[model samples]
Target: MNWIFLILGGLFEIGFTTCLGKAKEATGSTTYMWYGGFILCLFASMALLIKATQTLPLGTAYAVWTGIGAVGTVLIGILFFKEPADFWRVFFIFTLIASIVGLKAVSSH
Candidate 1:
């Protein structure tokens, strides 16, 4: 379904972000490898997004996609990049999650 495609697109968004972070810490040919991964993930994410938008409401799909990406990227940063997971960050993430769920619940398709 398009909703599944949208969610997968969001996950690829997270993949691209994670690749960028890894690239920053990489050296020599490894950096290029991560960049290649970035390009691949970016293309896949956009393709899926375009597919999902064909049937889904553009506004809702976009918001949900970005919501998943944002929340996922932040968690990835904390888990892999040693980024701080302070209280406010955690709180806002929960709020963002709630908003994403609310959007899904109210959507017609």
Candidate 2:
């Protein structure tokens, strides 16, 4: 259950970050809308993370959450932001994913 919340938090982390980039690109009233969405997502993400920490070890939870967000955000950048999908970049992303999985497997809770 805590893992679920943690993963949700991670996904929301991705959401807020992407929205933040969009917010930066927005102009005038649209900028305020984007910023509002960004803030909402950011708060939701943090709230879920706080919930997850109630049961999960903080170090493991934070690492896994950030790991998922980082990997997800990078993939999103590749797909939507026209970032290069170079070999080394993909390799490290997979490595981070593997590490996150390993951490989940080793975690007691």
**Candidate number achieving the greatest TM-score relative to the actual structure:** 1
Considering summed lDDT, which 10 consecutive residues are worst modelled in model 1?
77-86
Runs in model 1 with CA error above 4 Å?
Answer: none
Models, CA RMSD each:
0.4, 0.7
What is the RMSD of candidate 1?
0.4
Model 1: how far residue 40 lies from native, Å: 0.3
Error of 2 at 43 (Å): 0.4
Whole-model lDDT values for every prediction: 0.98, 0.94
Candidate 1: give the clashing pairs. none
Candidate 1 lDDT by residue in tens digits, 1-109: 9999999999999999999999999999999999999999999999999999999999999999999999999999999999999999999999999999999999999
Roughly what TM-score does model 2 have, to 2 decimal places?
A: 0.97
Which whole-number lDDT from 0 to 100 does residue 35 have in model 2?
84
Best by lDDT: 1
TM-score, structure 1 vs. true? 0.99
